[model samples]
Target: MPPDSDPTEYKVGRLIDKYDLDGLGQELEDRWLGRGYESQSLRSLADWFNKYILEEKFNRAGEPPMDGEIDNIYRLLTDDEVTSGMRLDAETALEEKDIDPENTRKEFVSHQSVYVYLTEHRGASKQHSSKDRIGSARDTIQRLQSRLIAVIENHLEQLRNAGELTIGEFTVLIDIQILCEDCGSSYSLTDLFDRGGCDCE
Candidate 1:
């Protein structure tokens, strides 16, 4: 383990060991920390995990999965925007493969899980990120954004378990919108930053 590595064993680390996915940890670290590689967001990392690792694993199984079967089913089951019909179809598809939907669902992991695996378990660090003021601000905002989501998720789960509210699958939205009083127009925080400040005379 690296000197900066955290000692906690995360869920993703256990899953990696369970699947015998050798070299995956190093590859993820390389992609994240290697110089000259483009910066990766948690979303992109999630996509990479699903496509190159998870889906690929199923493709190599004793009984080859139908082309795109794993991707489609997994998406329908986990995607926040998916409809009820889509989820039902995914379950049916799993049944066709002689897989139990409920049990299989337990094996899926999210992008956040991948992040924890790489950071806490693998001791991966972002060695290539810019260290300038603007870069630091951007990184701080990104992490805080993630923490905000996690906090809300935990509180919502607690409420559900306490029977304080009745809710189904939900999406969490945290849009920071700024209204330009001069122009009487609204813009997202990111858009404002990207445009180098709102257009004004």
Candidate 2:
């Protein structure tokens, strides 16, 4: 007599072989085959993977070394160079109008956080004599954005090549968000994949 053939059993066996999940496989086999859970086999296994294995096992198996890159980019964007350019322009304006530089700078820093200030001001005033400084700062920001995206995409490509993840799976895991430099618009990974990048000119 041949052994009983079950599709869920086959799938579980394959997962065990592929991932070397010896202990979990034994537990699952005992629960589904030995116990009376054969009817709910696949669902039970899927729930297990979702609740425990996805983060605990699968993510740990293939984590990349991109945290440092991300941190570097974030720090560059928020560094004093960028903030000082804005401060200098504001200071110039305040000084021209005979306002107290020290007190006004403190007030500006307190009222407007770095991100809010950068997004709101964009660059120095057109009439101010810091046009070059503004242009340089904008260029630096654009470069950093491009570099960050490139680093992330390269890492994703490596993971895909290693067969650790598919592009779809990777996108879901990362939940990527892109910012359009020209239009200051934000996009999701799904939106980028579906629509082929932002619609900025």
List the global CA lDDT of all models: 0.62, 0.40
**What would you estimate as the lDDT of candidate 2?**
0.40
Q: Write candidate 1's Cα lDDT for 1-201 as tens digits.
A: 552543234445555566677776666666656534665655556556655544544544454666776677668877779999989987876666566677556655555666556665666655335645544664466567657867997899889889997887543446567899998878765556545677686
Off by over 4 Å in 2: 1-9, 33-42, 50-52, 56-201
Candidate 1 global CA lDDT score: 0.62
**Any residue pairs clashing in model 1, and if so which?**
none
Window of ten residues with lowest summed lDDT in model 1: 3-12
Q: What TM-score against the true fold does each predicted structure earn?
A: 0.59, 0.21
Poorest 10 consecutive residues by lDDT, candidate 2 = 108-117
Residue 179 shift from truth in candidate 1, angstroms: 11
Clashing pairs in 2: none
